[model samples]
Target: MTFLNHRHSSFLRSITQIVTGALLFVAVVSSAKAQDEKPEWKAGSAAVVITPEEPTWMAGYASRDKPAEGKFHDLYAKALVLEDLHGTRMAMITLDLIGVPRSVRENVEQRVEQEYHLAPASLLINASHTHSGPELRSRYLLVKRHDAKWAALADQYANDLEDKLVALIGTAIEKLAPANLFYSHARAGISMNRRLPTPGGVTNSPYPDGPVDQDVPVLIVESPDKELKTVVFGYACHNTVLGLYYYCGDYAGYAQEYLEAEHPGTIAMFMMGCGGDQNPYPRSTKEWAERHGRALANATEAAIIAHRTVVHGPLKSAYDYADLEFAPPASREQLEQDKESTNIYVKLHAETLLDELATSGSINTHYSYPVQVIKLGSEILMIALAGEVVVDYSLELKRRFGNTNVWVAGYSNDVFGYVPSLRVLREGGYEGGGAMLYTSLPGPFTETVEERIYEKIDELVQEVSTR
Candidate 1:
């Protein structure tokens, strides 16, 4: 009887031990999963003045804004650093300039990569496309006159800008802690498609029927203490408000200023969307610019108050590049007339093309375009593209893959020139063929521009989805 009782006790003890071990295993797995599920977001921001004090040639549309006599306005350049909790990072530097030359962008990128070990795709540099700013690249085509003074100044400015950006990124990383990201979108109808359809049913007339991305996407950054640190918003409209000589960030800059003012202590970053063929309608004065800025700020405030969608969990990012070539311009004889004309931009570009054609015997074709996509956990996909992208790309992407989870950005990677669709190319307007004279490209993009863009985007999306 004693032996049987002892055996029963031993069996009970073994069963209890087994049960406890199972519970401990489950608890460990659950804890690990919870740790893995933590949302990742780290951010930093810095701003510098890239505006030139002296009068310089402005870029963007051919229209020029005369500078006020002996007066200068403040112009600003800003950098925003975004990274996952694990330290993988990306930096976006927005300049208050007309455009940045490819060489300038590449040099800065190389420096950043060498210094910080940042991937080229992870660093996105963009221009506000402010027509009131100085000309970074020579707009003249025929006479290759180098503004050594301006070039030297620009180089120094870029270097300074890079250092400031790096510092800002570092600060953001250091401040990273428990935070939450919320996204909300609203459409503001201030932007109108500048490319219109002609009476002959031909598209690309300067009449204003082109597609516009009115969706004002807002990303609200909150600290662990539940304070709003920043509001990053994007719109697809050219900031041509107050197009006067003194350097200014234009409507985009005003918008950021207004937002930050309204929400004291909160930073506002404006990511210009696909506004190549879009403009802020009724923009002719500084007051109008302020009004537009207020509208955007109001929209952001509404999103925060009404519907805030918070993003949680780890972040995943992916980037890819594609080379799309442009077809050679018209024959030298055909282009010579334009080249010899007073329009230095056209003349210089024509001569360059002619020289290339003469040397290669055939016009060189194709541009190496890059498309980058970043996914933040299961929510929010940010797609960045090169060039002055028109609104069609943004609209199409949002429509195809509901705007709730996608944010499309332009003026990213490289700003070689305007990137027009096949439809726009066929129509042959400024964004399509007319603007080619402003750049060093041999000619307008080949008809395959649309195909190449679509294919690359598709590949990028697929790659992210699979990952």
Candidate 2:
């Protein structure tokens, strides 16, 4: 009986040993699979100088400068491509220009989709809003300056930019490898509200005090070897550093230069946040531009020096487009008889809209707007909206969705014109009605613009979260 019991006990012990070995092997295999599944973040950056030899019109701040026959500060088209281990990718190309036209963006999108396999919505192209950069597609505003020569030159520059951007993205994709992403947000008070309100007047002063976005978010990219590869920063202010005709990238461009120089081989992408109503304070000089640049660079440096939360992302991206409609302007005779005829362009646009309305009886007041949201794991939510969005959208979204991580971006897909809030529409100002002259659109947006945008954003956020 004792021998039989010992044999049974030994058999049980042997079974236990075999089970333990199997568990260990499974653990090893699971760990190996996890390692294999770990996504690698690879990145690359390239810049193409776009400064013209001869002086031309600058973009923001409205002030003009004399022809620059000699060389001035150089403008650049900087491209940063980011890809995962599986080769799915996104490219952000920042241009040191006034504004990115819808046509130009579409052209670039087609090129990226054809060449880099990047989806049209995946490519984010933004302008620095530099007043010193050449005016590309503001013919509606600067009609007299839009000569055939200028148009040809602008087309050539845009075509060249597309090629350069494609090449840059391809190079970056080829240079992909493992990398780390860390994100941090800091506030800087370098910008002020450009549209200030006057006492007891519905009309805002040409120079009015308004709200501004002070938050500056920085995304630091590090190679797998732990070397700093890029520091992408965003702020909501127009880069109107120097309103001179000589080509310059303004403060945002200078900020990139400063950061890149400070950290060699490290690229910097400056994305303009919700700065439609914001303008850089103390602008209009190379020195002030450098100062602001250093301020932004310092903010980035501080974010890096301070403890930052490393973000591991299994990125999920979604893009949605909506049609936003605007009310047609009054009849041509009525518009001609209306009060605010100080700007000839506004009157002309009104006349044009009225002509269409008279012929068709009703204008097709709808515009195709794009909204894109990207979720980085369960943490970061990056929302991109088309047109020049005001600060209220960002502030409101941040307040309503404080529980979730949100980064709202404007000047994304199609930059038709200023996307004013309901409040702005009611107030009746440049952002609401006056700014419509800047586009081919009829007039002020419908009062439902705010609600339309909010609903679309909510839908996009939900889609991204669920997916």
Candidate 3:
């Protein structure tokens, strides 16, 4: 009887020890899972319709003879503010317009700093390069038509837009909440290299063999409960699918619209990549635009579905200007001759330069081009380059940065004109120099343009990466 009782006690003690060990292991695992699931970032997003209430002059194509009469859909300006665990914040504002003027960026930067205490380095303004959006540059209209009414309308719209954008940023920041960030990418075949090489020169035609960046990079933001919040995706293609009189965001707008519809209560923002020389094929109709938009949206969705890298962050941002030199300005005699030409754009450009020479004493030999870099922990490196950047920059940067999670965006901050790579510049094409005939800038950039931009980008990247 004593031996039996001792055996029962030993059995009970062993069972107790086993149960306790199992519980301890379970507790340890649960704690680790909880820690892993904790949000590493805070994010907020807001979007506002920017479509003009009244008849507004359209941007992109200068050939349009009249103001916009109707609408395919309303345009938009969206803001997304992201904060790291340490409280470093970065605000990304995207416009469904032709470009982000330097003036607009400067104004927003100054006001956001003053009002919201958001540093200029923390602000990133990108444009969709939508050809159908309202003309934000009053001077372009003023110089082209010499109509004060048109210029005033555009100027008034721009001023109102500034206020709207600033308020939108504030709203986004106010709505910040705990969130998770992710990075993934998928490919879409909508963009084709428009810089076709021909015996004549580089014509703006589809070059199937030419390099293109069709990889659509996506940044997903979601709540801790796994509710999708914001989807920010990027594509390296011109948003010039439909150049109709009515306002539209083209394929970009359609993609955002589709994404938002598919994910109810979510905001989608499109960032233009280095697609200065890329264009969608079979374009010019609203249907085609919608098709391309759907394609891009599908690609984004696929990216989201794919395994995504967890974007851990103690976000760091840096911004600076690159002094991009213009090739020597056309001589006075050349300008004088150009002013007398039959081409209105050429004459206007020459007259604009001559006026600048008269007013400022000399033509501007260099432009203070804006360059920005944002590093998300050690996982992601985002480099935003101003102007209509060519595809080469995108490909080269990805190559140089190892292409894993590096995102290079163009048409950011100040999309003054085309930014051709050294290859494109040496090739001598529309993007190389001929496109300058349409702008008031003094023709092609100097050879050092690419080098100077790269130098600044490297400096900024190093500055942000270290912190």
Task: Write down the lDDT that model 2 would get.
Answer: 0.73
lDDT of 1 by residue, 1-467 (tens): 46668779889889999999999999999988866665467666666666665555555555553322321355666666677766777777777676656666677777777876777767777677776676665434114564555455555555565565566555555555555688888877778888766666445324445566788888888775568887788888787776665566777777788787787878788888888888887777877777887787777677777687777534555666677877755776877787787977777777877777778887767677878887766678888888898887887888776744888888876787888878778877788877877676876788888788878887887786786
Q: What is the descending TM-score order?
A: 3, 2, 1
For residue 438, give model 2's deviation from the true position in Å. Answer: 3.1
What value does the lDDT take at residue 13 in candidate 1? Answer: 85
Instruction: List the candidate 2 regions with Cα displacement exceeding 4 Å.
Output: 1-39, 61-72, 138-142, 200-210, 335-343, 350-363
Q: Which candidate is the best by TM-score?
A: 3
lDDT at position 320, candidate 3:
95
What is the RMSD of candidate 1? 8.5
Worst 10 residues of 3 by lDDT: 1-10
Candidates 2 and 3, the one with greater lDDT:
3
In TM-score terms, candidate 3 sits at 0.94
Question: In candidate 3, residue 153 scores what lDDT?
Answer: 91
lDDT of 1 at 449: 85
Count clashes in each candidate, considering only residues at least 3 apart in sequence or on different chains. 10, 4, 0
